[model samples]
Target: MTSNFRHVALIGKYQASSAGSTGDSSRQALEDIAHFLERQGCEVALEAETASNAGLTHDYPSLNVDEIGARCDLGLVVGGDGTMLGIGRRLARFGTPLIGINQGRLGFITDIPFDTYQATLSPMLKGAYEEDLRPLMHATVVRDERIVFEALAMNDVVVNRGATSGMVELRVEVGGRLVANQRADGLIIASPTGSTAYSLSAGGPMLHPSIPGWVLVPIAPHTLSNRPIVLSDATEVAVEVVSGRDVSANFDMQSLASLLHGDRILVKRSEHCVRFLHPQGWNYFATLRKKLRWNEGGS
Candidate 1:
């Protein structure tokens, strides 16, 4: 209940105007938040890119991610989950707490809506909020036993067919043990926070944030015998291309890299975690019920 925050950083989409929400109109909503923070005697700095996108005047200070992470107590994201994902990956390494204001559709992680952001903003400024520490995944692609592409994902890492319409063959292993030889469109390795994302659309189960596990989902598996499985987050997963065809590896549905024959992808829980600050009264189940429209029917 101690509001020790002093410096705050504001980050938004490069083109906030692309969003239909008023929040993005000349970055008006972000300006409003900055004013509110200033009123609290907090030093506000905008992310350099976001400031440039908004055409911010020289009156306000703009800093890069590294500077903001080094100086700021909280980083505020004023766009959708996609924006949060990108910023989260960078800021998480600095251990800076992040708060999101949803300005896009289906903002599962960006919980605060533009309309009610002010109401929620007050408590957060006073250090009255909940914190959720989420895990990240480290992925590396190996060719001929040499490491090639590598990146981190806050959501899921997928090994998918590149251009061909046909399913691909993959050999999946857990902790150096053979798990399955899967023939499918692709394979998804998702963290608990990602269970509600691509994995969910692939018929994977929803995992609570408290679950210390990761999910393996086969996308459009050729056989009905293939089912989604949840394993300990500590488990390391290795996916090898059994077929001679090339495939694509995607991280968080953003970063992409091509994988050739004999290529292997190694995925494991990352030592770093992203910390999200939620307004008081925020409920994970409630958010899920609303987002998934689970309120429609129940047992």
Candidate 2:
């Protein structure tokens, strides 16, 4: 079949060790997928870090993330959600669409199963696919009116007290209006795409990806009445560390430690969004049911 994506970038989990069992399997999968893409009339390139960590020595060109973003029409991420999250954030700026092949547990965003990837991916290459646009959150840590750290999160932005520290006091604001002053273990500012991640575990609602909203969930709040609240994505949310010991902020996998009093975490919707391509007829609810085992005991 003729491919809609002529130049495709293949990214594997770089953290996998070449000598480990998982790495060996991932390497084999990458090779097989590369060959399959070739047969589909698509030119494939290996992501530089994937090539190095997987010990790949294929004739295909190995390119960095910037190169892939500029040149490739599609990015096929072969790993778990974490791998996809890392690449998604990087590729969002370039507007390059992505497809995820599940190589790790709890695929979530990486919904394609390895065993059936060839069957699923072939049609997608031929323009038979579903497009999903997931929004990203831009988080910044501001201290004393200066920007200290900044990152993009596809999941959630978290603020937490140190492991040994007591509860943190955070003053929350939305659109420059005071929302609350809560004493809690921490706070989570999660985008719709992040609703099912850490936020879900912290008692936040599971928001559909199509929702244009954010969920604020407090972790172990001292007040029982403190509950998760959803707000429109158009507004900016600020969380200031009013009082805490060894506080920190985390944006998805990226973290900034040693937060002091008055350090404010600013979160807003990013202008760029990640685009995911799935097989035609893919349904978000179906994915949730399958992954969450919602029908495990159904007849």
Candidate 3:
């Protein structure tokens, strides 16, 4: 059957190929997936970085992120959640749909198992799938009344103290109102989709993906009274560097910028959202059960 998506972009986890054998495997996997996509009557292209890092020399066209966003109807990401997160943020603006094939340990977002991808993906390409829209957050660093740096985060925005530094003091605000003055090793502002990530690890609540909210969690606060809080997504959040040395802000753990005293990291809901295509009958709870071992002892 012809694919519902006529043009597809193949993206692999090239970072896993630090070893020679791993590189070969990554290259082979990309080639294999490309052939599979072609058999489904879809034109395939390799993402430029994936082709370069994996040393792919196939006759298929190699395209950059912008090119893929402009031309491809579907993006088939063959990697772990990190790979998906990276490409997801870049492609969100273009509104391209993505499907993930798991090659990493935790397949939270990359739900499809690699070994059985063929059986699962075939039908999905033909429009037999579930679609999910995940929102993104826009974060910016403002210094001296000017925006110094900015980026979009699909997961969380983190402000952390340097490894050698002591606790950092942060002044938090929500919707232009004073929230609290927190002293901690760091602070995490996570979207609902990121609740299971760094936020959960830092003692924040697990927010369902459908929730229109954000979680603010402190990392090892100096005062025991400082705790995690969930806020409405419509509200804007700002965390100012009150006192800290060698502090930095991370967007989705991908982009980073150093923060100085009085520097404010502003965060708000982004206009763009990522589109994920899951196999029919896919469930969020089912994914949590499998990935988090929630049903380990159940029948």
Q: Give the number of the best model, judged by lDDT.
A: 3
**Between prediction 1 and prediction 3, which has the larger lDDT?**
3
For all candidates in order, the CA lDDT equals 0.88, 0.91, 0.92
Spell out the clash pairs found in candidate 3: none
Worst 10 residues of 3 by lDDT: 290-299
lDDT of 3 by residue, 243-290 (tens): 989999998888899999999999999999999999999888888888
Model 2 misplaced stretches (Cα beyond 4 Å): 296-299
Instruction: List the candidate 1 regions with Cα displacement exceeding 4 Å.
Output: 1-3, 17-26, 244-246, 296-299
Candidate 3 lDDT score at position 169: 95
lDDT of 3: 0.92
* TM-score versus the correct structure, for each prediction: 0.94, 0.97, 0.97
User: Residue pairs in steric clash, candidate 1?
Assistant: none
Weakest 10 consecutive residues of candidate 1 by summed lDDT: 15-24
Order by lDDT, highest first: 3, 2, 1
> Residue by residue across 185-264, what tens digits does model 2's lDDT show?
99999888789889999999999999999999999999989999999999999999999898999888555656889999
